[model samples]
Target: MEKPNLFSIATKELSQDAFITWLLQWADDKYKKENEHLCLLGKEFAKSLIKLDKKLNAENIKIAKVTAGRQWKNIDIWAEINDDYALIIEDKTQTGQHDEQLKRYKKIAENYYKGERKVICIYIKTGNECNSSLQYIQDNGWYIFSRSNFLAALKAFNTKNNIVEDFTSYLDNIEKETNSYQSKDKLKTWLAAQGFYLWLEKQVTDWNEWNYVANPSGGFLGFWYYFTACKKTKGAEIYIQLENRFDSGIDLCIKIGADWERTTEHLYKVYGILFEEAKKFNIEITKPKRFKAGAYSTVALVKNAFTTTSDEKLDLEKFLTVLTNTENLVAEAALKC
Candidate 1:
């Protein structure tokens, strides 16, 4: 049996925020005598935030104060270093930024400091997200502290503290679960499917957006790109959607966002173009037996979309080629319409 971990049970964002706050608090000089290792680790974390500013040298920089949660503008974590820099961390587990919260948080921090200290905003996501989401964070002026980056910092300390060890172990386990798709012959769990989606997000360069869509039946990881506006319907567009449920196959579909009448019209137009283009690439995409019309409806599908290796493992390269070819097909078809 696996050993019990508090973090594995207290998996909420509040729990993670508390852990980060506790670690950052140890950076103060008062904690050096209590536990030297923790103090050093805390200081290292403080440095990680400070190092984001090219003008600021984190070496020999001393932390003045550390605050977390409700104490300071409801920010997840805040650290004041040497009267010159204020680091604000907006921590997230599986959620993405909404309601322009990143911009709002940065503005709040800057206004609070009022030009006295350089406010550095960091967005830390410990869970999996698509590259497009990460890019959006960067575009909004927040430095992204990813899962791999956090793991690298924690592993570097090699501390014996039980709290640190447990947290590290928990995070490492999550990382392994998300990466298990590489070795497994099938996508057997939600984490494995998420891993596969993340991998595809990284490999497919032409996709405009990718995210997890929640539904009553079950959530699906969806990728959308090659948007072609419908010439007939206003505020309607047709795009290629790759929906993966880890059921040993991917649904390569052409979807539209409009009412049923316009959706069917746009879907068929784009579907016909893709059908012709796919043949040239030796790809097989067939019309679904039945088409449903709704806000987002699938008009066409590519059956058995993924190619497999001899041992029945996923063929990453061949599958990627198919996806890229599909994108090309959509792009070419968009021009004609």
Candidate 2:
């Protein structure tokens, strides 16, 4: 059975301004007397907010007013406590920090804020990790609150309650998605620590004639190695396929970016170049179903190199030789194109 999103909102907006608005409004005390059960939700949320900064005393805190999408240059969510402290929250979903936006926003928030209130900035996201550096966000006195931490606080608040349970289900979904990508990141880090990628890096440096640089964005799985050509050509990669518990194979493939104009003729031309080059090394080309006359810019398997051995361990040396030879062939083909 499909799970229900309580807000009936798009998953993309689940962590965006909509969720922030709903959270802050719930945290506001004026809405408390209206529904005590729902008011508990606000109390729990305020607990998380107060715990965010140790310097702020929760005893002096009073749940006051909440605003969103306006005031202070359109911050995602803003909450005031006891008329003396202001909390500014900025939520980022499926996006990275842009143009020192956090720093700029903090400055704007402080400058635009009125009265003798102490302003605090919070950067909230579904995940704690990002490709960009978040040092500036931390350095500028902004607290980081990931969805994991928020969900933990909510779960601890109350579990059997119906309203909290429904909200938790929604948060669980987002946390599950975040875990999926985080697992891939762990695999990528593990693969980089292994000998294969480091050995390939050495090969690229030693065999400078190939005009190819090693890149690790082969796929989410850690079984592939990617190489980018110097002449603005689509990259080549090799996939490690395990079979029969004792036999492993290397699949030579090409990756075409979406910007590359893919055509059947161009596919065939590149396939022919790779085919002839593999034949020179006594490596037979494998025409998989995916390589059959079709327009695909993502991946095209060109050949396979498989071997049988009784040992349980992988043949790193032999596989490395095969991969380097295949990459050289791909480099030559790219130069011709």
lDDT against the true structure, per candidate, is 0.76, 0.53
Per-candidate TM-score against the hidden true structure: 0.88, 0.51
Show the lowest summed lDDT stretch of 10 residues, model 2. Answer: 238-247
Which stretches of model 2 miss by more than 4 angstroms? Answer: 6-9, 59-72, 159-167, 180-337
TM-score, prediction 1: 0.88
Compared with the true structure, what per-residue lDDT tens digits does model 1 show for residues 131-243? 88888888988988878877877877767999998889888988998987764444656676778878776665555677778987587777787776755455666678877
What shift in Å separates residue 319 of candidate 2 from its native position after superposition?
Answer: 16
In candidate 2, list every pair of residues with a backbone clash: none
